[model samples]
Target: MDRLSTRFKGTKTYLTNAALEASVNCALVLEKPLLVRGEPGTGKTLLAEAIAEALDMELITWHIKSTSRAQDGLYVYDTVQRLYDSRFGEGNVHDIRNYIRLGPLGGAFTADKRKVLLIDEIDKADIEFPNDLLHELDRMQFKIIETNEEIKAKYRPVVIITSNAEKELGDAFLRRCVFHFIDFPDRELMERIVKVHHPDIDERLVNQAIETFYQIRAMQRMRKPPSTSELVDWIAVLKSAGVTNTQLDQNLPFLGTLLKKEQDLVTYADQLAGGRRWRS
Candidate 1:
């Protein structure tokens, strides 16, 4: 954890040994599911993305939705491909069954090699979805019930599941996973993250933005203040356009590039008018 650095040169993520050890254990040793719980925009999903990117592995992400069903985990057979095959070929039952395609999970398991499985925002998914995935997690295999044929994984990729802690998961489901909570980084760590993401951005701007975000954060009204990634977005966009604090007045329209909500933008504009140097 102490030695873990950002996988990408421009990445702001720096995980401690605790986080790294947990991930490595889940991926290589424990061979168990990892459940990451955190507040919104705390880089829970980014953890999985960074590991997959760092390892040069395939990233198979399932963005869990409220209606996501358990069966949707496997490969989605291209109906068009199946139909074409049926028309052109002898359409034997077994051949037709073989023609059906694999879903994301199925592909992850039975593909030519291993890949990272990011079940993102699992809290949005139905309870049955997690329960259904238990078997696959335990067995490292999935059966396409449509074909009544089993497909096993060549290698079980890192199974990283992220949740916003919106609801409580079943104890049985919790029993299958190694759980951890991701907290917001402190000011010093936040500055390190800023420099890591936007090397060319002036250090002053990074420092100012961090302080302003802290101001916004101090307000209890906002849903969530700017996070490290959002800070990256603001700095990256500003630098890419060659815009700086000196020219913010001329670039008012580009304010959209940084602040997201209209209220935040309004507040920033007011801050600028009060001679507070919002951009700087």
Candidate 2:
């Protein structure tokens, strides 16, 4: 945390501050999990990565998806596959137990030393999933059935959970952690973002892209507007392809980088064909 440059209120810097300072404070005094919420592409998951890097902690990230189950994170049981194999090979229950593959949660809980655990995108996961994590998260440990013993960490792992607000999580789950919400950065800070991600882009092009980005976002076309990532990618694509606003050809194929929707492409093409500025 002390190692991170706090001069900028940019998204990455804000996340770094929140993740490291919050986790260190929580671990020392509060002893709570950290829950981070933001829009997609706002760098919620990256917080743990930056924290682990700054503190020299090993990072273990488990991306939560629609089909993710509570037990899926706890342990990966391969007994079914083993049982099928034993029908052809030597038949034994011991071999099946031996083959049970440990999943991320089991591995993390059982592994020695502290680690940064990232439960990325809890909002996308099943409704009951977050609630089921309470016991394991609170205890900072879990029990593996095969071993018939509890796995406790000498140094409790820093747990960073990210949610995109796609859906609300249970109150029981949200109550378990210290929370942080990351809103999008302002223009000046966003320009710094463009600079951070596309350092080699021309200043004029960067500024133009940023201005156009805000304009397009304001339009709020049928599809969701482009994000900070798209703006950076747009600039990078422009520079790499040697495109200026004037060259025209270089910007056509890469409009997908700038505009993320079908209607947006049509709208942009219409604006370009009409020689319009696309001002809001």
| TM-scores for the candidates | 0.73, 0.78
**lDDT, residue 277, candidate 1:** 46
lDDT of 2 by residue, 131-211 (tens): 888998888677767757666766667788888888888888788788887767678878877777766767887776677
Residue pairs with backbone overlap in model 2:
none
Query: Least accurate stretch of 10 residues (summed lDDT) in model 2?
Result: 1-10
- Give the distance in Å from residue 1's predicted Cα in candidate 2 to where it truly belongs: 16
**Judged by TM-score, which candidate is best?**
2
Q: After superposition, how far is residue 159 of candidate 2 from its true place, in Å?
A: 1.2
Model 1: weakest 10-residue lDDT segment is: 2-11
Pairs that collide in candidate 1 are 1-16, 1-17, 2-17, 74-103, 75-102, 75-103, 76-103
